[model samples]
Target chain A: MSTDSVTVHGYSTSGNCHKVRLVLEQVGRPYQWIEVDSPNGATRTAAYLAKNPNGKVPMLERADGAVLTESNAIICWLAEGTPMMPTDAWQRAQALSWLFFEQYSHEPYVAVARFVRGWTPIDSPRRADLPRLIERGEQALAVMERHLGRHKWFTGPGYGVADVALFAYTHCAADGGFDLGKFPAVEGWLARVGRTPHFVPMPLPHDDVRTLLAQH
Target chain B: MSTDSVTVHGYSTSGNCHKVRLVLEQVGRPYQWIEVDSPNGATRTAAYLAKNPNGKVPMLERADGAVLTESNAIICWLAEGTPMMPTDAWQRAQALSWLFFEQYSHEPYVAVARFVRGWTPIDSPRRADLPRLIERGEQALAVMERHLGRHKWFTGPGYGVADVALFAYTHCAADGGFDLGKFPAVEGWLARVGRTPHFVPMPLPHDDVRTLLAQH
Candidate 1:
């Protein structure tokens, strides 16, 4: 696939969006990135919602006008038939299980907390939910810690999209008030993911959000 | 694959688990069902957690000891090469997007509200969340309503796992205090899914939970 034929609409700071970028980068697939400022009402715009009724990012648009949404789904499509996706059906299912885990179990708590802390004002009423978010996020981290104790990668036998899916939110979980120090195995796994070839870090939150993150 | 070689550990009331059973039934694959009462601490047991580190129900186990969790992944595996899964890569990605949306956007609100309303006492503090859950669940329903208005099914030109994934929670969304009267298109889609070959409805919640649900 030609890099210029694919366009990704995403907010750079979002772990969900960053997961797609990470996979594309790791695979050396070039694509255009259109910044969709989700936190500031961009995604909810009628124009954006027309593209994705769910009003979220990142969204992939092909040259033929075909569109695919959901971060994990997009990354899976980008990495199809590559080393990033397991060829074995059972292992692929196992990898997809972790992808679902990242979205359902891990991201909701960890990523939402990060969004709340960084994007909202320090005294925003939403901040009140931080304690519960942190607790739940820790539980998710614990699950990863246990898995990492016995396995080197979330995808069977190698680094792949599952690791990328997980690493997106997990590496930034501390910003959500999670104590990564308590989960050494997860910390090591995060390091391993970061050291993978062609790895690119999620960009820093924009300046205004960075200021709020620091205050929170 | 012989049905005798498959075992599914699940909570009958959970939409996630029920999606797996619905697919197995639709596909005419008979499998052993081990009822794990998740809300009653069944999934948290050390034995159950050993089989699924995430400690969630709807786990698929093979005779060879391989296990897969995450309802969408399990259903996709069960539906592989069948009409339930799209053969075209774009349609498959689109189906997966709905699966992700079902878990992230839809289930968290719709399914959780149903669990709270059906399992908790009317006066329980969790009931306080019902208003918010209803609001968000409606948003998810609206998205589905918009899509169903244009497409008869979530997957391209046919009913598939995406339909099953959304149907598991959506068909029972009224239990979560959502008034389906507003979403005519979605209501029609649900009925269409019910008429699919070999369809099976989710089992009713248990007697005590029924009492709680009635009172709520």
Candidate 2:
């Protein structure tokens, strides 16, 4: 860790949490990670809730104890004044627009579908939502596909925070039973994102999650 | 409208859309408003989809024909360089965190509950989700209550974009069956937001929707 390193409290396998790590690594910022087993009531602990009343990960805490929550917001802050965030006002607006879309339209469906499919039991009633989640998730992917067809990045002219934000869940979309093959543009974009400098893949889920994923 | 004015295509009654109008009004930025009847398929038209693949409002269009989407993103951009957006990097990050929270944690439930109750038929199957929506919406309210107990605003030291973003849905929470009386701090903040310069209330839903809300 560097003298100015920040700390990230996150669940390793969660895409929202992985987003912070990927950006920090890519930006070459030193950081420490404290894994929070969010699914097992870890984030609900009094200590955790005191730090983040919203009770979720990944959270970025500075040495001074000022903290930032919300994955997109954290990355945006980490990427500011770097090439990871656009400097042009209009381009920055475009990047922020995609960030909002990911949270509002993409993640809730794509990420939630993956969690419901892998984290929940086979007979879990939430699994019944797969079809609707897939449908909505597809709408989001198609929108991305349309954009990737004409542009290389969500942040103008480069791989930046918006790409990082979307790629977190998108690369693992298959876990949610989504067929990325249907959207060739998105697949190509994902590959392009994978090739960006200092990029790191999200860690594999633990044995329990993997077994559940395999069983289903 | 001024020579540099932009246009907002939005459904008048939607809180997300209303956020754009509110910030633009408060900033005194000249803008043209084109009412989009989102729930009735106005946004689904091919012409609209060509401009915004996400097919949602409010969509902000520049005079040069460029466009920006996502309601929170729109307000952030509009408020940039104004007192409504913090100039300090950390304060900006905090404002953004709340903006993401409003979309992900609050609007999906609070705003949707209002929609299900008022826009859908009384016998519509979506009403079945209301109990769950209300539950989740209350959790979001509790988080805000906790935050407001210590801070005067979501944005540091002032009412800004985050406050506008949250007030969009929270002020109308009663329409979603949310009881503001339970969250006194949040109620106070809402009243403070109402007194901001040029603050405008979201347009009342039409008679058809009002009748459904009254029936419910």
What tens digits encode model 2's per-residue C-alpha lDDT throughout B112-179? 99999999988999999999999999999999999988899988899899999999999999988888
lDDT of 1 at B196: 97
lDDT of 1 by residue, B45-89 (tens): 889989887889899999888899999999999988788899887
Q: iRMS of each prediction in angstroms?
A: 0.7, 0.5
Candidate 2, residue B171: the lDDT equals 95
TM-scores computed on chain B for all candidates: 0.97, 0.97
Off by over 4 Å in 2: A1-3, B1-3
* Tens-place lDDT digits, model 2, residues A120-199: 88889999899999999999999999998899988999889999999999999999989999999999999999999998
lDDT of each: 0.89, 0.92
Going through the candidates in order, their DockQ values are 0.87, 0.89
Q: Per-prediction RMSD in angstroms?
A: 1.5, 1.6
TM-score of 1: 0.97
True contacts kept of each: 0.87, 0.84
